[model samples]
Target: MARRSDDAEQLLLPYPTTRRQRLEHLAHRAGGIARRVLRFVLRWLARILLPLLCAAALLQAFPYQATVQGVPFEVQGSLFTRPGLTADTTLGSWEFPDVSGVPFGVHVRPEDVDVLELTRLAGRDLPGFVEELRVDFAAEVPRIAWWLVAELVVGLAVGLAIAIALEMAVRHLRGRPRREHEVRQRLLQFGAAALVTLVVAAYGVLSYNENWVRESRLTGTLAAAQLFPGQLSSYYTEQSKAFDVLGSVVGIQAALQADIDDERTPDTAVRIMTISDMHLAATYPLVAQYAANYDVDLIVNAGDESAFGTSAEFTPEYRQAIADLAATTPMVWVAGNHDSPATVAIMRGIPGVTVLGTKTAVEDGFAVGAGVVEAFGLTIAGLPDPRVYGGPGAYGADAPDVVDPLQRAAVREALGMDDDEDGATDGGAADGENGGDGGAADGGAEGDPAGVDLFVLHEPAAADEVRELLPGQVRQTVSGHTHRQNASDELQDDDAAIELVEGTTGAGGLDNIVRGTERPPIAFSIESVSADCQFTRIVRFSIESAGPAADLGTDPATPQAYGDDVTVSTVYFRPQDVAEGRRCDTDLGVGAERPWADAG
Candidate 1:
């Protein structure tokens, strides 16, 4: 046995570990037992820690008390540290009640807001009064990540490589030929290589270098802040909420731009309802109901009053029938690309609806609602039929109107626009599988361009084109193809011509929309409030016809003067009733064109 021990010793190198090492290994085993006891306690701590974290998350997700008691311009922008800060706690009296578990209140002072607007912004609804400042946890991430990642990778690589190398070297020196010993040596070698690989792959290559990071992180600190209620903010938000609700419930938010000059301003009280793209046979009842009962002095059919476009989509009797539907009311009809010239002729022949499509002299005028004498005040001219890519889906025009005349003409020519033998417009050919017959591409008319009070068409781009074609001459433009109501506040003034959209008032989604919204889902687009089956009271207003309206304090019933002090008190038309359940249902819309999923 002694000789065998010597042989074992001989197998090891000169500086190999001796019998003393076994004693040290025993000491290490004792230390390991103590570590396991420590680990058992840590495991219990970790279990409790997870539940505490869950409770914290729950508390964070629950909404806190919201006290809106101060100003209309509440804290919408970034808070704190940005100046123009009003004195803190400049009280107009702020208070709040506790909410479900969470609490918050009127955290803004009166000095922080505009005084006159205080009444509008302050909270009438106070739900809480607790303020727990959370350190917007997202802000801490970049700082911790800053130079540390690369450095961490380097340190980890160096330390792990050394640890693994030491294990392998120690194994070799001991000359341990045990199966477990050789396995341990090979594992250490692999771990060393993996460490080097991870450092280079993750940190050295993937991480953004110091200079690039600095350029990107210039203003991250500017974004972080805690949310709390303020007086002016609350008041403004409440007013906005009130307007949004009333506007939505009232149905005008879809296409009526009433109160063009804000209620705050003493302007003419004008209520307008415009409907376009009335695909007559399909959604006539919905349009008729809106037109017959809604509180609109001016009801307009922008264009495509019928789906009578070419020989295929149009039947002369159907055209006459659709035109007859509007014969009862003083309807103003424009031509869509879909309407054939024959369909247009039938429309012009209709007694009640004055067709403003073919460009004629000053005497051959059209209707633009109630007032507006030809040549002096308002004028209506018909636009040529718009070009189509074989059918409707083939064409795609999205940019702003082309400015240069030569460029515009070239575009028209490229689209296959040319005059027919009778000098009438012969439609051009379209490009691609989606192309259509192109004719109305450049929005020019057949006769003298009398200054129109408004230009009407089927698409919004048509108005933009007419404006581009005539520069300053065309004042107001109305269009509809979306089969939805859209009104413009930006496009009106004294000598102001605005664009109005009145289409598919409440036929929900007759225009490719799987789901519609009361609030605009996209940032750039306006939210449309759908018209319900109720009687809508639209106040017809003539520009500058009456004196400024009285500030009757948010009361719709308050009698007020029109601009120029006209005492025109119109009667309220009664509203229709709802279909079945409570409010209007626009989401799960179904039916012919709606289910077909394409626009006119």
Candidate 2:
């Protein structure tokens, strides 16, 4: 009992008041508080940071589609890695090489542009249109920024929910009770995984940039190089050549314009500017500038203005541009092989533009004597390409506007169709006279109120047939299907119509941009007619290469010679010269073989 009492006394004795023991107790309490605070901070940080990172990763993995200015585009979040704008130019996907190292990429889906949109866009000039786009993009920045922010907020909310669900799923899979230490471990694991992923992605991107993108300078189509065999080297070479030619094109154009500006037109002369085979090449601006400089009174487009005679090519914008061009000077157009019946219909709809065939003849898709129309005090007639009319001898779609044979005959007769019993065309001249001299007579010349002043067709081969059909009525004949410039008074019998063949004013169409082939010079013909409707002169303007597409010599001082050839040559017409009357100071005819040819 005494021992028991003694132990109780010891227990009740004043707890040892040692300072070391008190210090040890305080340290243990402090450590517990610090651990709680650290766990709370780490938990919140993981919730926010993990979700944010996940949202960013998701955005980088997907692309967004949007349309601007009626054009479709694909936006990719590159995370400031590969910033660039690419365009589907039909020929190829072209990434603008100048813009790189940005956070995002935009790809223009040109294929998505409908006919109407294409037409609208087609009418806009390049420089001005680009400026407008720049302004529009700048104005849209705030909206785009706000949109991105909203996307981020939504993505963050989604990410947070997904992370919470995943955390619950992991706990369930482990079949373990939730613990503060486990949460900390998860946060650390997630951080490590994210860092490793970032490093791997960065390394891959760096490798790709070094191996392909940067080495190639981003000039050629990257897809083409990767997908097509034998395209890598050839494409780059072409691109290099193309960039080299641009400066030359500008310089050549300027020089040609200067020469044209210096040329004088006679006060009494009626100037006729001829262009053809545009093929939707965006050559109108250049043509318009040249026409304005020349002060042309009439503009004639021989044919091939449309590509494949598609309705899409005749957009409102394109039509408006044509109309604007016509507003400055009257325009006459003949149907070429490429100008379908529908294409012709569209052209006819444009104001200030005259589709040469008579209304009835056009409806029949044939060129008859009645198609003559008076413009600029001159009687002009056109022959539609027979190939565009479907039937026995024709090779095209049977048009809705085409009339039956009876109606066609009546229309032709009403307009002056002369058919003999043999079913061959006879007495087809504007006048009752069957055949007369082709020369333009003074007052009663064939082109007066009674005759056709200018006979126009699409192919040069058809000129002989037209001159035969029109006889002495046609003063001059024009054609352009050959995409070559030529002037000749074939047969030289003082009765042959002088044929003027203009070249491809569209510089061989827009495909030439990618063809990378040496192309013929852009050319146009200027026909100066006397006050009496007589042909005075035909001047040919052309831009060609001054020399081969290389340095003239091996010498370093020898400048590379390419696209410096700009020429303007005049061919004079003398109505009275008995044999081969047309004369040019330079050799400028079809084969450069006119008897009167002089290399001026």
Candidate 3:
């Protein structure tokens, strides 16, 4: 009865008897649980994580390899082999000595491997698996290697911390007094192991830069080294010498290769071919062939068919080419600086050719200058070279030049728009009446004239003045005389126009011949226009020189000329008809419904 009463009294005394004793008892229970958990984790690290880390390090240090055709090759991922064939053939003998008599260690790629055979050996679709592995290897190898090192460091730190915690917990649970010196000793040993692990990780990263460990099968006979002195010293030096010799011979061979099939056929409703500055070279046959093959509807020559605009310069060959072109397709000619009065008359004499002169007139709200030819469902205006009126020489006598400000005002008067009035230039009756079905008004500019679709001339420098004469309505202007081919930026401003400068088509006469650069940069444009006066596509054609100077018989000092190589490309423009809810396929019929009339 007394023992039972004593046990009840002790149980009711809060068990630990004091606050400090109660706290110690709770800590002992927690330490025991922590120790058990730490031991399990330590076992896992030893049995699983440690082995994985070692294996990864070993694989990275020495990559796996396979024998192909009796030649050992280092496998790059699963699909490729290291040291490509070019490197092996060029540097193998010297860099990798052939210890064995037979040439071994030749480079191989995945494509060279027999997938069927590999699959048979592995009894599965090894090639497909290998392909997937290759992609993963390329993307993840570098990241994975660094991740492995990071894992090692983190695992070591965590393991050491847990080990120290477990030791403390064990001592506390066993009712042993904490030994500070023994704990310090255990910590020092674990810390040293962690430090050693960190050092190994750093060394492993550095060792990745070293070449893979492999025995060289090639024997170092040095036979080729003895035969070709200085060849093995630098691979680049040998390559440089070889390319230099090849370059000298390449120029001549390139000149002979001509490719006319490269010309691009227009994919538009209406096709207009624009050629300029033909200074009387034998390019008309090629030009005629291009037009006929592509089924060109119209041909526009911006001028300079002769050097001095002399009658004698129009040789039989030149005339014959022009006659043949006009025979098949209707052509329009604008006078150039080089075209004299005699030259103009000769061109006008051609049955299908219409020659333009200098004058000012207005159609719709926009002023139409002299040489306005309405054909192929569009209005084409032209300006003669300003040099023909007052600049520098005898070239001015044959044709009058009206590029001055006063002449431009006259153009306004012809369009029936008063100067300085600044009246709105859109949605006017005269705009619709001038060209009738032949013209289409600018949808953006109200009360403005339908305006000219294309302005043809011999000098691109006159574009600014021309734009001033026909504000907000000139879509494009074609010109030549600089003997260069280039197009201006698209008309982005409300009143800007595109200026296309045609390069020399006749190879620039003596300038090209004397320099031995007879083949010149010649370009023609295939333009597609919608029935409602919108352009859909403007494809530019030009010749690119594929051969070197020696082949073209050009002087080494002379610049390379465009020859047989032809490149076709397109230029973008705002679609006018498409925006107006009109289809581009609307047929406007062939030829004029009535007799052709000039905008006078």
**TM agreement with the true structure for every prediction:** 0.33, 0.41, 0.45
Q: Candidate order by TM-score, highest to lowest?
A: 3, 2, 1
Q: Per-residue alpha-carbon lDDT of model 3 for 54-93, expressed as tens digits?
A: 4344433444344532223443211112221111221222
Give the root-mean-square deviation of each candidate in angstroms.
Answer: 21.5, 27.4, 22.2
Model 1: per-residue lDDT, tens digit, 1-600?
A: 999999988887544276787677778889999987986675445433333343333323331222233322222111112212111222211111111111111122222444334323322321121111112212332442332343333443554445445545655787955456766765675565566545544543444232220111000101000001112233335434543333221221111113222232222222234555444333343234334443223335565544434445555655554554555334556565444455566666765555653422122222111111121112334454343313332222322352223223422332223433121112210111111111111122112122333455666665555555454444456666655444322334343334555444223222233335331110001111223222222222111212112332321111121111111111122222222221212222211110000101
lDDT of each: 0.34, 0.52, 0.50
Lowest summed lDDT across 10 adjacent residues in model 2 is found at: 591-600
Of candidates 3 and 2, the better by TM-score:
3
Of the two candidates 1 and 2, the one with more favorable TM-score, higher being better, is 2
Report the number of backbone clashes for model 3. 22
Per-residue error (Å), model 1, residue 402: 13
| Alpha-carbon deviation at 406 in model 3, angstroms | 11
Evaluated at residue 437, the lDDT of candidate 2 is: 27
